[model samples]
Target: MNFSAPTGNGGTALLRRLVWLRFVAVGLLMPGLTIWTSPVRANPHGGSVVHGDIHIGAGTGGHLQIHQGSANAIINWDSFSIAAGELTQFLQPGTSSAVLNRVTGGDPSAIHGALQANGNVFVINPNGILVGPGGTIDVHGLVLSTLDVSDGEFLAGGDQVFKGASDQGVTNLGRINAIGGDVFLIGKTVTNSGAITATGRVGLAAGEEVLLTAAENASGERIFVRATGSGVSGTGITNDG
Candidate 1:
């Protein structure tokens, strides 16, 4: 995987200035325990080159690059895992192709974050791109999956031009949600049994004020408060719990 931004793209140069941030974690190793707090840990920026295979552990998240100048990454892992907390990871391939795989499980392993990929992300292997029941992809920004045809902008597969074969597909049996950015799932084949919420919002907006309560009535109909609008014209209300 290689990333070479076009000239005059100062924003990408600024992205390089984020410094090599190390992610540290402290928690249990159980499957369901949300015990890891990744506020502090060591995540390695091994190099700025994509040699062949890339591997990321379940302990900490790192800022990695490929092809020297290209910040793109090609990871070949036996297993990838992450717990919970504000453990964020940024896997940027820009215009390059990136690979993520799960080797041992018919059920896809779980990863936690705002797990992000800044460029066209590729999920390849005999297993293909499969997200299991507990797996989730929290897309706070751009999310590129191997589920659609590539347009050369944010996705780069499915055309069989850069990537080798198109026999592999993507299956998301988990959750993929958008917090503040667009969500794009690109692959030759896509099967989504989970939820894909691109509403761009969760509970409330930033700096919003809420003063309400939930009370029960004599009929026991589970009465709850519902409010939407702050003097805005198209203030919509969506109730999904």
Candidate 2:
């Protein structure tokens, strides 16, 4: 399944605000001027990295980009925050895993590939979570983001297993209940195809006002009891088979 930002002038403003709020949410003050440079790498064990900074490393099978702001500060970064001269990693020799834990930072941080967060975490992207072959991301706290299976065919072949391995091996688990925001999907063109299982209420909202709770398979499924002050009274979409 995929989720996309509604196109038009209205979406443009929302995207801009989201981008700006993201920067402030993490306390990143970029120079008024854009810097076309790579971020400094940090060696947590070597103290080569600074607190509240992002780190990039090379890998054989893939690449790992870690952003762990200060221990006291939050770690927030937008997936759209693009840069040049950035190191692009390819497949590593062995099945490698990348983990992005809050360790001690902010509310939401953009993590690519296999990742793990221990503290309160938020993923702010139309399709925030990306799962690859041998790629498994685990979260101990709230995972306010969308989960995606990238290149599923190639990652797990046509079957649920890849190279005799279970495709479900690359799973994204949200240990804590998700808070604010909605899960988003990504694709060239968004389509409603994935299944979302929420333990909490699911419905819609209009500026803190919940208006409807379409069918279960309904795209843009929202949980807005907080806004409406009333709960939905219907059997949400479900699979009978």
Candidate 3:
């Protein structure tokens, strides 16, 4: 059954099959190919917050719900915190070219965003994920992420968990609490210094070094902490919350 360029009763079917295969093959190898759950876009106006692989939005100290439509959320503030009763997710799956799946914030812990989610708050940045020194994540649901996972609750068994491993790294120096979920952080290298209060569990999976510290949670839970590897500075899971 030579179907490369068949010319028989099954030629049309063969051609269709070949075309489908070619489409898939090209989708995997093409340079400018895009695959996403929705059409993700960047902000028409630019955001200013930045640090390494992290970039934040203009939070503005208002209750704004970011739908992951055109750009990553860059939270900013003047004096108050931002409140959002929605889950911030990526517009689509990540590609190295346009990994539009990251959430960053202002420095000095000035920007505080309160998030409420039914499932998981996802940040699937292939470049890298970073929570700055002045950033804050306050959520009441699972934070499903591929790299940096903190500043919120991480509920387990949430829908469409993005466990994709990033080559860069995952670093956090803020605060996180999983009131009813698990905050799972997976990457090549992971660093945690702020605070993580997980009602379910807190996980850190890294390839090279994993830096962390223990702290007391809001509920008076004293958890031990430590770390391994060279680049990391904090002690192994020592509780300091």
User: RMSD per prediction, one decimal?
Assistant: 19.6, 17.8, 20.0
Q: For each predicted model, how many residue pairs clash, with residues at least 3 apart or on different chains?
A: 15, 15, 35
Residue 49's lDDT within candidate 2 is 29
Residue-level lDDT tens digits of model 3 in 124-222? 444444443444554433332334433221222112223333444445656666556456554444455566666555654433222222342464332
Whole-structure CA lDDT of model 2: 0.23
Between candidates 1 and 2, the one scoring higher on lDDT is 1
TM-score comparison, 1 vs 3, better candidate? 3
Per TM-score, what order, best first? 3, 1, 2
lDDT of 1 by residue, 126-237 (tens): 3334444554665443333322212342123221211223333344555666555333332333344455665322121101111111222353221111122222121112
* Each model's lDDT: 0.31, 0.23, 0.33
Using Cα atoms with residue i matched to residue i, what is each candidate's TM-score against the true structure?
0.35, 0.28, 0.38
Candidate number that wins on TM-score, 2 or 3: 3
Give the lowest summed-lDDT range of ten residues in model 3: 14-23
Question: Distance from true position, residue 157, model 2, in Å?
Answer: 42
TM-score of 3: 0.38
